[model samples]
Target chain A: MDLLEYQGKQLFARHGVPVPRGGYAATVDEAVDVADGLGYPVVVKAQVQIGGRGKAGGIKIAQDRDECRAHAEAILGMDIRGLTVRELWIEEASDIASEYYASFVFDRAAKATLAMLSTKGGMDIEAVAEEDPSAIARLHIDPLLGFQDYHARRLCFEAGVDADVVRPVSALLAKLYEAYVAEEAMLVEVNPLIIKQDRSVAALDAKVTLDDNALFRHPENAELRNPSAEDPQEQMAKERGLTYVKLDGDIGILGNGAGLVMSTLDVVAQAGGRPANFLDAGGGSKAEAITSAVEVILSDPKVKAVLFNIFGGITRCDEVARGLITAFEQIKPQVPFVVRLDGTNDQEGRQLLADANLPNVHTAATMDEAASKVVEVARA
Target chain B: MSILVDKDTRLCVSGITGREGTFHTLNNKRYGTNVVAGVTPGKEGQDVDGIPVYNTFRKAVDEHGANTAMIFVPPRFAADSILEAADAGIKLIVAITEGIPAHDELRVYTHLKRLGDVRLVGPNCPGILSPGKANVGIIPAAFFKEGNVGVVSRSGTLTYQIGNELAQRGFGNSSIVGIGGDPVPGSSFIDIIELFENDPQTELIVMSGEIGGSAEEEAAEYIAANVSKPVVGYIAGFTAPPGKTMGHAGAIVSGSQGTAAAKAEALESKGVRVGRTPTQVADIAVEILGG
Candidate 1:
C-alpha cells in the first residue's frame, strides 16, 4: 500500500530519519495555521499517492499565509492522475545546497533488497537509469548480513556526495534502511534528499509502499489506509476479504486464482469483450464468499455481465457452483452471468448450475467459450 | 525422471490437519504420490488419511525418511514452515500457502538460497507434479497425464488450463511446476528451466509467464544460451492496465517494465514459440511434440 507523503514522513521520523517539519491538514484554514505555526515559506504539497505531483500542479510553495491558503484550496480538490487531493502536507521549506536521490527497493532479479543512491535527484530515476546508469550506485544488501555501516559508506562515496554531507547522508541512509525493514516496506524512496546549508541531510520527499501482506504485523500502518483513494467496490471487496480491482469495461470477472483471473481478462478481450474489473475469489472460497463477490460486482452498475471462470484446485467447483447459486438467490442480479467450471468436482458443479437454469445464466465448457459467451451476452 | 518430483519423492505434508492440507494430501495420495508423513504442531501422533502426523518437520524427516515437504500452512506461518522444512533437510520444499509477507519471503528466500541444496517451488503456488509418479501441493491431479513435455509457470490455474489443454491434445506433461506469482517468489523460471533442460525424460518445455518483473526475459536468455529443448511460451496480462496489480501481486506493469509484450518479444527473439492465448500455447506445444 502506498503511503501519503505525510504518512511516509511520520514513519521515517519514527525511525530517526530527519524529515522537514510538517503538519497534515484537511482544510484550507488548517493549512494556513500550519504554515503560520511553521513560520512561513512552507511547501503546500498535495497528499496523493501518485507521482509527478509538482508537474500536475499538486505542489506549491507558499511564502505567506494567503498563498498557503490559496495553494491549499487549489490543490485540495484538484485531481492529480485521477486521485483527488483531499489532504495537504504543509512542510517547512528546506534550504537546499544540493539534491540527491536515495531509495531502498526489492531487487526482484537478485531476490534481495537494494539501496540505490544517486547524485542526480529531483527527476525521474528511471530516466537516470536509462540515460546515465553510472550516476546511480546500487548496493544490494544481503538479508542475512543486513545493511552494515560499510555498505552505507560505500553508497555515500560511490554516489559522490560532497564530503561535508557524507557522514550525515550515510547516517540517514542507515536510518532509512532501518525504517524500510522495520516497516516491511516494498519500497522506501526519498527523492531529492536535500542537503541544507548547514550540511545536514534530510528527506525532502517520501514515497513508501508497505507490503500489504505484512500489514498484519503492523496494524498501525494498516490503519493508515485511506478509503477515499480506493474505488468503493474495491474497498468493499477488501472488507469482504476478496481481491478486486475496478476496471472500466462491462464484463465483471470472477476467478479462483490470480493468474487465471488475469488470463480470464485477456480471454475476455480476446473474445471481443472489455472486462469491467479483475476479481479473484481466491483459493478455497466458499459459497458465502462467492456470494459476497457477486454482490460486490453487482454493486458496480457498469458491469453488464458477470463471468465466473473457476479452475478448482484446492477450491472445489461444486462449492463454487453452490456459491454462485446462493448468490443468485440473494442478489437477483439483473445482468447475465457466464459460468465456466473446470477441475475438481467440475461435473457436479456444472450439473448444479445447469439444474438451477436461472435466467441469463450461461455455462460454457471452456474458458474461450465462456469468454465468447459472456462477451456476446453482454453486448446483446 | 521428471525435473523436481518423481516416483521416488517421499512427500510430507506440513499443516496437514488444516482444511487445504488435508484435502490436497488425500488428492496427492490418490494420484499415487507416496505421502509418507504429515506435520502439524500440537497435533502430533495423529493421522491424516493414514499418513502419520508429527509435531515437527524434523520428525517427519527423521522417522518417515520424507525427502520432499509440501507446505499448506497459513500465510503468517508459511515462512517459518518453509524454514523448518529446510532446517529439517528436506531436499525439495513446495509451499502451497499464499499471502506470505514479502519480508518473510525475503528472509526464507535468503536463508534457502544460502543453504544451496534445498529447492523451493512456491509459497503461493500449486506446487509441482509429475503425472503417474508423484504430486505435491494443490494442483488437481486428475488434469495431468504422464508425458514428456515439462511445464513451469508463475500461476496456478493458468498452468492447469494449459496443462489440461495439452493433455486434451494428447501432449502429456513430464512434470508441471508452479513457481508462484509473488514479486519475490522462492523459485524462478531459470531455476526450473535449468532442471527441465537437464531432465532426461523432458523433450520440450512449455513456459507460462505473466507481466511483472524480468524473470521471463531472463529465462528467455537462459533458454537461448543453454536450453536445447523446444520451448513454447504464453504470457498473460496483455490487456492488463499499467500500475494495476492484476490479481497477482507481481503481475503489475510499472512504466515500461513487466509488460507482456516485452516478455513475449524476449522469448520470441530466443526462438521460443510465444503464444497470445492459452489454446495457442497448447497448440504450439502439441505441434512441437506431435511433429
Candidate 2:
C-alpha cells in the first residue's frame, strides 16, 4: 500500500505538482546515464518503503556521473527497516533555501479529511510536533466542499508562511488534495517542499500511502505493488486471501475476525507470551481459509506455538473445528496447538476436536486458559 | 431502550438483489429483525425474502416508512448508498460493507455530519443491535440477552466476544454498537457514548477501543465532563508495540498520543474503570452495575 518516493512523485506529477526531473535506476549504468541527462549534480536516493533513509546513508549527493554511479551502487543493496534497496531514484538536485512540510490524511477524531502544514519541515516531523506542537497547522477539510484555494491559503497563513509564498503553496496543497482524494490515498506527504533561491517552490520529497481497500478501483496502482517487498508468510497469506499481519513474537494466533485477533494478541501477551502474527480468516471462513491461515503461521520459523481463539457466530464453531482438524493433518505442525472455541454450536465444535485425538492439541474452555496454555508451551 | 435500533425500529435493505444482500436479508429476517423493504436500483417490483423491493431508498422510506437502513453494497458504490440514505431522511444508516476507500468514506461521513440529526453507524462495521429484538449486520444473534449494560466498540468481533462474556456473567446488554474501524466513519465513540449516557435501560457502559486516533481520549473527555453512569473501558493494542499498525484501515499509532497507555490513562483520569484484559471487561461491568 506504500509507494516509494519516486513513484509518489510520478503520481504527484500527474496532478500538476512540480517534482525535480528524475529516473528510477536499477543498475549503476542507468544511474550514470540519468545523472548525465540531468547534468552534473544529482541526488541518488534509495527506493525503500520506510523513512529516515538520509540518516541511514541511503541518500547521497553526487557531483559527477562517476559519483552518481558510486552512490547508486552503495545504495543498491543497502537495507532500511528490513527493506532492501533494489532500485535507486536519480533526481536533479535543487538549491533549497528553506524546507516546509504539508500532508493530507484522514483524521479520525474529526471524522474528516485533515490537512497538516508546517513551516518547520525536514528531519522528523514527529520531533517538530512534540517540540513545538503549535507550529503545525491542522485543518479538517469538508469533503463536499473539497480543499479550496482559500482553505489552503488560510492554513499556510496559520503556519506563519510568508505572504508571498502563500499562492504557490496553496496551489500545491490543492493539487495534493486532488491527488489524495482521486487516488484514494491514505497519506500524501510532501516533506521539505523546498523553496529555491529563485523564489520557486517544488516538492523535493514525496511519500504516498494508498488505501489498500481501494486497490480494486485502481488497477494500475495495484499492478505497481511488489509482492517481493512483503514478508514471505505475509505474501502467502495474501495469496490465500487471508488478512495476516506479522508481529514481533512467538505465539502464532488464528482468529475469525480482526477484533478477535487483536484481543487474542492482547490476551496472549497478558498471559506472558507475545503473538507472532495477527491472522484473521474472516467471516464465513471455510476449511481452506482456516487451513491456509494455520499453514501461514507454521511457515514462520519464529513461531513457537499456535493458538486458535475463535468466537464463531455466522461461522459455525463446528466448521472451524473441522478446518483446524483438517489443517493440522495437512500441516503436521511440530509446534503446540491451543484451541478456544465459543458461540454457535460450540458443543459440537468441542466434540469434534475431542474426537480428532490429535497430539500436541489442547482445548481450553475459556480464552484465558487457552492463552495461558499457549504461553506455557511457548516458554517451554 | 436501545441507543440506535430497537424492536420498534423498521429496517430496509439496500443492494437486496445481490447475493450478499439476499443472504444477509434472509438471515436478518430469520433472526427476527423487522425488515420491511428492499432496495435494488432496477429490481423494484420483485421481493427478496418476502420484503418488497424498491428502486431507491426514498421509495422504501416513503412506502414502508422505514427509519433505518442496512447496506450490503460493494465498496465502490457504498458512498453513494450512504449519501442516498442520508438524503432520503433515513434516521439510521448502517453500512456493513468493508474495503471502502478512505476518501470515499470521508465524503460520506462529511455529508452525513452536515445533514445533522441522521445517525450513521459504519461502512465496515458489523452494525448495531438491541438484544432479542432488532439485530442488524452479521453479529451472532445467540450471544446476546437483554440487560442493562450498553456496549460500544470499534472492533466487531471484540463486541461479540465481550457481549458473550457479559452474557455468561449474567449481565445482559441493552444495546451493542460497532462504530467500526474506518478512520472516517459515520459514528464514533462520542456519538455512542452520548446516546448511552441518556438511555434508561443502560445503567453501565463498556467502551472497547483500539490504537488509532484520539477518539477514545475524546470520549474520555466527554465522559469526564458529562456522563454520571459507571463506565468500564478496555482498550486493545496495549501489547501492540508503538508504531505497529493492525488490520484496521485506520489502525496506526504514529505517535505517543494514540498509544494504549495514554488512552487508558486518559480514561482512568476521567474516573472510568479500565480493564486490562478482555475477560476482565465483564467483571468491571458487574462491579459498576452493583451485581
Candidate 3:
C-alpha cells in the first residue's frame, strides 16, 4: 500500500527520522488554519499517492494567510496526473542548503535491500540514473546482516555527501532503514532529503510503499491505506478476498493463477480484445471463489464479456464449472461467458457446464481458443 | 536423469499436520514420490497415512535418510521452516506456501546463499517433478508425459499450460520446476537452468517469466554464456499496467522497467526463441527440437 506524503512523514517520525513539522488539512480553511499555526512561509503540498506534484502545481510555498488560501484553493479538487488533491500537508518551510536523494528499494534480483544515496535529489531520479549513473552511490545490505553504521558511512562517503552533513545524513539513512524493516515497506524513499542552513538533515519528502503481504503483522499500517486512489472494482474484489487488478478494455479475465491470468490478458489483447480487469481465484480455488471472481469481473459495467480460463492443478475444473453456474444463478449476468477447463477434473467440469448450458455460455478447448471466443463475443 | 526431484529423492514434509500439508503430502506420496517422514514440531510419533512424523527435521533426516524437504507451513512460519530444512542438511527444499512476508524471505535467502550447499525452490510455488519418476508439491500429475524437454517457470498453472501444450503436441518433459512468481524466489531462473543444462536427459528448455524484475534479463545472459541446448522463452503481462501488482507480489512494472517487452527482447537477443503465448512457446520448442 502506497502512503501519502503526510502519512509517510508520520511513519518516518515514529522511527526517529527528522521531518519538517507539518499539519494536515482537508479544506482551504483548514489549510489557512494549519499555516496560521505553523507560522508564515509554509509549504502547501497536495496529498496524493503519485509523484511530480510540484510540476503539476500541487505544491506551493505560501508566505502569508492570503497566499496559503490561494494555493490551497487552486490545488484542492484540482487534478494532478488524474488524481485530485483532496487533502493538504502544510509544513513549515526550511532554509535549504542542498538537496540529495536517498531511498531503500527491495532489489528482486539480488534478493536483498538496495540502499541508494546520491548528491542528485528532488528532480527525477530515473533521469539522473540514466544521465549520470556514477552520481548515485549504491549498496546492497544483506538482510541477514542488516544495515550497519559502517554501511551508512560507506554509502554517504561514496555519494560524496557534504562532509559536514554526512554524519546527520548517515543517521537519517539508518533510521530510514529501520522504518523499512519495522514497517515492512517495499520502498522507502525521500527525494531531495534536504540539508538545512544549520547543516541538519531532514526528509523534505517521503514516498513509502509498505508491502501488502506483510500488512497482517503491521495492523497500524491498515489505516494508512488510501482507498480513494483505488479502482472501485479492485476495492470490491479486495473486500471479497480476491486478488484483482483493474484495467482498461471490455473483456473480463478470470483465471486460477497469477501468470495464467496475466497471460490470458495478453492473449486476449493479441486476439484483438481489451481486458477490463485481471482476477485470479488463486490456487486451490473452489466453486464459491469462482462465483466471487465472476461477480467481481461483471461488477464493472464496461466488461462486455467474461472469460474463465481454468488450468486446474489444485484448482479443479469441475469446481470452476460449478462456480460459473453459481455465478450465473446469483449475478444473472447479461454478457457472454467463455469457459475453458483443463487439467484436473476438467471432463467432469466441462460436462457440468454443458449440462447446465446456461445462456451465453461458450465452452472453449484451449487458452488461444478461449481468448479468441471471448474477444469475438465481446466485440459482437 | 531429470534435474532436482527424481526417483532417488527421499522426501520429508514440513508443517505436515496442517490441512494443505497433509493433503498434498499424501497426494505426492500417491504420485510415486518417496515419502519418508514428516516434521510438525510437536506432532512427534503421529502419522499421516502411515508416514512417520518427527518433531525435528534432523530426526527425519537421520532416521529415514530423507534428502529432500517440501514446506507447507503458513506464511508467518514458512521462512523459519526453510532455514530449518537447510540446517537439517536437506539437499533440496521446496516451499509450497504463499504470502510469506518479504522481510522473512530476504533473511532466508541470505542464509541459504551463505550456506551455499542447499537448494531452495518456491515458498509460493508448485514443486518440481520428473515425469514417470517423482512428483513433489501440488501440480496435478495427470497432465505430464515423460520426455526430454525440461520446463522451468516462475508460475504454476502457466507451466502446466505450456506443459499440457507440449504433451498435446507429442512432446514431454524431463522435469518441470515451478520456481514461483514472488519478488524473491527461493530459487531463480539461473539456478534451475543450471541444473537443466547439466542433466544428461534434458535435451531442451522452456522458460516462462512475467512482467517483473531483472531475473529474466539476467537468466538470458546466463543462458547465453552457458547452456548449449535450444531455449524457448515465454513472458506474460504485456497488458499489465505500470505500478500495479497483477496478482503476484513481484509482477509489477515500475517506471519503464521490468516490462514483458523488455524481458522478451532480452531473451530474443540472447538467441532464445521468444514465444508470445503458451501454445506458441510449445510450438517453438517443438520446431527447434524437431530440427
Stretches > 4 Å off in candidate 3: none
Candidate that beats the other on DockQ, 1 or 3, i.e. the better one: 3
Which pairs, if any, clash in model 3?
A: none
Candidate 1 C-alpha error for residue B256, in Å: 1.4
**Model 3 TM-score relative to the real fold:** 0.98
Tens-place lDDT per residue, model 3, A1-380, is: 88999999999999999999999999999999999999999999999888789999999999999999999999999898888778899999999989999999998877789999999998999999999999999999988788999999999999999898889999999999999999999999999899999999899999999888899998889766563497789889989999998898989989989999999999999999999988899988988988888888888989999998989898988988888899899989999989899999999999998899899999899999999999999988
Per-residue CA lDDT of model 2 for A24-86, tens digit only, reads 888899889988998979999988877789999999999987788889889988878888888
Q: Tens digit of lDDT per residue, candidate 1, span A1-380? A: 88888899999999999999989899999989889999889999988888899999998999898888889989988988888878888999999988899999987878899899999999999999999999999989998788999998899889898888888999999999999999999899999899989888899999998888889999999899663487899889989988899989999999988888888999999889999999999887888899999999999999999999998876889999999899888879899899999888999998998899888899999999999999999989
TM-score between candidate 2 and the true structure:
0.96
Off by over 4 Å in 2: A133-135, A160-165, A226-229, B242-244
Q: Evaluated with TM-score, which candidate comes out highest? A: 3
Best by lDDT: 3
Name the 10 consecutive residues with the lowest summed lDDT in model 3 chain B.
B282-291
Q: At residue A168, what lDDT does model 2 achieve?
A: 87
Model 3 / residue A151 / CA error / Å: 2.2
DockQ of each: 0.77, 0.72, 0.86
